[model samples]
Target: MPAARTRRARAARKRQRRMAGVEHDLSADEWAGLQEAWGGCAYCGASGAALQKDCVLPISRGGRYTVLNVVPACASCNASKCNDEVTGWLRRKRLDERAFLTRLAEVHAGL
Candidate 1:
């Protein structure tokens, strides 16, 4: 368990380093607005759970924590989506790829 925890911590640090020097313009108000707009996990539509700030493109893949790149996601979806491209991960999970894309575009437009 300790080793697992250490490994996870190391991976998180690496991700942080990868994110260094990248844009991080998502604000608190923007996060609130995003949650309100989505009303749940943006991918799975699961409401009433604490949402996480998930990058549409993972940080490891050069995605920043910017407004257009971030979305509200449930813990499960966030964990499952670790380091994967959004569309392919959604497809693999049997999620509505087109719908997510459309909604994402709408949300970004509204922002």
Candidate 2:
């Protein structure tokens, strides 16, 4: 049988594919970075006690369900960031855009 963590990671990937577009198919390894960010919101460093997968770029703006775009989030961060430009939203929240971008770049690079 597959391990529980493996199963969750797979589920996350499936969700990503669904988010990208119904016709778009994807695999788990695409966002393996999510496993590393499992415990907290990649945005505010908030505990992802209830983790949310947020797209860095809005799907409306053509964000794909790819590792480079998705990041772990807490419920609040995800809700507040909904559909806004990431940098603009982060600035409105008084969050550090540079740091978040740096972290995201690292995650993308690792992939």
Among all candidates shown, the one with the greatest lDDT: 1
List RMSD in Å for every model shown: 1.5, 9.7
Worst 10 residues of 1 by lDDT: 14-23
Whole-model lDDT values for every prediction: 0.93, 0.75
lDDT of 1: 0.93
Clashing pairs in 1: none
- TM-scores vs. true structure, each candidate: 0.91, 0.70
**Model 2 clash number:** 0
| Residue lDDT tens for model 2, 21-79 | 73333357654447574447887897627776678887757776566677888889988
Which stretches of candidate 1 lie above 4 Å from their native place?
Answer: 1-6
